[model samples]
Target: MAGKLNILFITADQWRGECLSALGHEMVKTPHLDALAADGVLFKRHYANAVPCGPSRASLHTGMYLQNHRSGTNGTPLDARHTNWAKEAAKLGYDPVLFGYTDTSQDPREEDPESPWLLTYEGPLPGIRPVAMMGTWPTPWTDWLKANGYEVPADIRYAYGERAPGPEYEDGAAVPRPLIYPKEADDTSFLTDRVIDYIAESDKPFIAHLSILRPHPPFVAAEPFNAMYDPEAVPGFKRKTTHDEEAAQHPWLEHQLGRKLFRAPAVEKKLRRMKAVYYGLMSEVDEALGKVFAFLKESGRWDDTLIVFTSDHGEQMGDHWLLGKCGYFDASYRIPLIVRDPRKEADTARGTEIDLFTENVDIMPTMLDLIGAEIPVQCDGASLRPFLEGRAPATWRREAHWEYDFRDPADDSAEKRLNLTLHQCTMNIIRDEKFKYVHFTKLPPLLFDLEKDPDEFTNVANDPAYLPVVLDYAQRLLSWRMNHDEQTLTHISLTEDGPVTRRAARY
Candidate 1:
């Protein structure tokens, strides 16, 4: 509480909120993250505000909702005027460093038409310095792999899928094999090494973002981790018996299921195998993080550091007959959140599980708050400092909110398929203790009674009995949006004398 606190912000890609062993997950064992939660406070109902990587991170880094940020898709550019946590921290004299990618799409207004950064959405956040950046290309990791005498692939994207020398089938069935690279040379390990090296050499208090890409795509794990969990032992999918039955839920669900990319494999054994590999990848990441946590304690930085462990978004993992992060389901938005404030004031809250609704937008304000930086007026979320100090805020949100835009500007695929305009290819969700309402721009709305049908297998919006509940939630969602619209200059007024301005209250 006295000196500048070191910040270690860690994000694992495509991690489900319920997969942690600390939360009683049946199969996945994330011992290192569970230990971090023991020293931190874990929010049970935390959610990402948007889907995929870029849009979710835009909300995460800027503390603004997707509606305010307007970065709806992966390739959508983030507005240049927004002030992010990195920029706010930089103002307070802390050099924010990134060990991996932020998945930021640079605002086109700030770049030339031919600029290479404009070509991809996987750009770095504006204020952070990249120590070892990993993205779609992952040049740094690939270069390291090549330098270490490993046979690099002709196409770098295939690096992670490269399997060890072995038969492709076992007992007349296809199985996931370990990667050709050893565990020490894996991408997760490389990023962890960079973070450890940076912390070892830094002389002053540091702010480092360690973004680990795992439990994501190319789901194969290395060596021992590949066999860590038995495929049959993993929990079964939470979905209807057949894809056709699941797709009947809604028009959007039907559209998503029709696409091969989003649909789960038709083969049941393959789907189970993929789920097992995903858990294996999670275990590998957990082990890598164990090293970082150990190094922090050994280097005497553990007590002085504030660590936040989370994910950009959640993975569907064959849930509801889907394989990727998209749509309006909780499986795509609800993610893990664990905040470990090193100050003595936070000790009382350690190991506590908060059931409150927290979103990815809260991350920016929380980091800024811990560092004593000004939370920008553009931020739509409140700081979690009060919770960290063992007290709940007077007014806390009871519901979680998220938005998804299915529009494809390049090909107009969603527009053409859904028979709607680009703007109509979007949906917003408001979910609380008992009910969830999904409002689409043009499609039919979906309302689920979470208590009666927690799996969201049925929609009750059309039922006369639930019509009032839908109306109430719709009004609440509208009010929530109206209240959070961009406020950067809304607090300032032009006067005859001089400008009079008031700071925006986060809550």
Candidate 2:
């Protein structure tokens, strides 16, 4: 085996930042991840730069913000010119292996319009070597389920806890049910098995990106897990008692509530049950990760591997009366970030937690920094290598910033519904220690004093007393946007002898 250090980058979809027991989450118990944090550095205030799957993963892979990457939504094409971590790693002589999916919508310019990849946003990113592409509807896993003697549904989505297996509830159930497949053949277990096999068969140092899609949707779990949590014991939602109360906060909240996407059902029992199922799914993923950790240790690669565990974006999961990832709420943007660097210099920083703000874009640069690769000029993220080595950067970011583009090119539903232009269906958020400011393209702004209203129930944008704070954050957001404009080739210049280049580190 080549002696290059291995990179194990793992991502869980729609996982909340506050769901980890290691981070003092009361309801969820994440023993596997907790152990991981015991040997890793945890970023307490990490956030994703974009929303949904495709766009968030775009920021994560390219080390660029939503504005820079321009892959704003699912099915939106990622610009072919931009280089991702996988493409960069390939140049460094490491074959980036994807065990699960990247949720990258291929650029239309590089593909035939009639191609199958163009029909869906679930395609792998350019330059990523997908060993097994398990996504929203994993065909490979479904085929494995069939071979394992389970009755496969005509539409695999049904088997994802979307509907009951009985003929009576073939379409869907009023309440979700356990998946038809057993625990052994479920998505998490299937992906884990494939990852273990890949590690076992590999002889060379590998760059493995394992994206786990549990606790993201369908909110269902198999056997022992489905019955593991008691719905009654689940923590209460951190939201107003009624959806109407939340909708009254802002125009966007009203739009989201009217769409009925984030608004929970009226039934208390159903909502709690769904939350319980989501927690169970998290536990299931944690269990699956435990196996992978064991594989790394037993295979004698634990000390040589750099492990990164995070999520693309966070799920609302009934927080703020929301179920999906949208709006400027912390629940939809803040996510867990744990990095376990095996270098001896990082020993003192082990089990430590950093409260400084970090974003999803920083991940690519951090990975690149660890592997001794040059971070690209286009990346707007900074490396966390300093924190990993028990030292904090002198000029670290003081606030967390994120952008969400709600435009739908295929159909301008958000614009039409919100009574705004296509360009107006966008927003940016700037969150610091004491306050969070949300600025929409055309809609009224939102300001929350997080210290007083941590649940973000009250919006103080119109309050005359808080105008100074609002103005300060608004200017900060604007300056941040202007400062981070794409620098792909701006750092290079033509010269008589050759091109003079200013590296990303210089800028």
Work out how many backbone clashes candidate 1 has: 0
* Tens-digit per-residue lDDT, 1-507, candidate 1: 233899999999999999899999988899999999999999999999999898899999999999999999989999999989999898888899999899999999999889999999999999999999988788899999989999988999889788887764233434567888999999999999999999999999999999998988888788788888887778989999998999889988998998989999878777887888999999999999999999999999999999999999998989899998998888888889999999999999999999999999899989888888888889999999988999989988889999998888986777877789988888999999999999998889999999999989999999999999989999989998898888889898899978999885645
Record all residue pairs in model 1 with backbone atoms less than 3 Å apart, i.e. clashing.
none
Q: What are the Cα lDDT values of the candidates?
A: 0.90, 0.87
After superposition, the stretches of candidate 2 with alpha carbons farther than 4 Å from their true spots are 1-3, 162-177, 504-507
RMSD of 2: 2.6
Q: Best candidate per TM-score, number?
A: 1
TM-score of 2: 0.95
Best by lDDT: 1
User: How far off is residue 207 in model 2, in Å?
Assistant: 0.7
